[model samples]
Target: MKKIIAYNMLMVALFTPICCAQDIARIVEDVGKSVVVVIGFNVDSTANKLGSGCFINNKGVILTNAHVIDSCLSLQIELTDTIIEVAANSNGLFCTTRKTIKIYLTKCS
Candidate 1:
């Protein structure tokens, strides 16, 4: 009985990561729609830099790093289903939506 219990514990420990991974995968798949790629555009409409953001209130509020749009004249949000370009207002370290909103690219830092 002791040996059986030990074996069961070992099995659970080994499979725990796999189970967690699957759960994380499912969560990402479900919530990935809320994620967006924040693109900063210069005055000439040229892309400057890219950052990541997510919807805060589902009503067009986005939260992202301030540095992403520090010097940007405009902003564009790339979502899974659509892309939205709008004016942006940046404070010291926060972005507030003044208007209206990619895929699974496997690029890593």
Candidate 2:
């Protein structure tokens, strides 16, 4: 009985990390799909600031620091293959220049 218990414990210790590793990999892949690059530009088309953010929901809402989009006349959100441009309005609402696209999150190296 003692030998069997020791073997089982050893097996679990080795397999636990493997299972955890697989879970971590899947999570990274899933989150990577939502990562975005935020670029703020001035009225003259010069880049003002660059930051990173992720989509918090499916409704095209992004969660980022206020300083990322501060004092910019327009903003650009870069996804895997899409670039979304929006002008800064008085109400802080954004109007996309193109059709709506899905957002994904990612982990940056």
Question: How well does each candidate superpose onto the true structure, as a TM-score?
Answer: 0.63, 0.78
lDDT per residue, candidate 1, 1-109, as tens digits?
9999999999999999999999999999988978889887777989997999887675666677776776677777787977766664343222334334212111122
Question: Which regions in candidate 2 have their CA more than 4 angstroms from the true location?
Answer: 89-92, 102-109
Give the best candidate by TM-score: 2
Clashing pairs in 2: 31-105, 31-106, 32-106, 33-104, 33-105, 34-104, 34-105, 35-104, 35-105, 35-106
User: What is candidate 2's lDDT per residue for 3-84, written digit by digit as tens?
Assistant: 9999999999999999999999999989987888999898798998899888888776677777877777788898877888
What is each predicted model's overall lDDT from 0 to 1? 0.69, 0.76
TM-score of 1: 0.63
Q: Candidate 2 at residue 63, lDDT?
A: 76
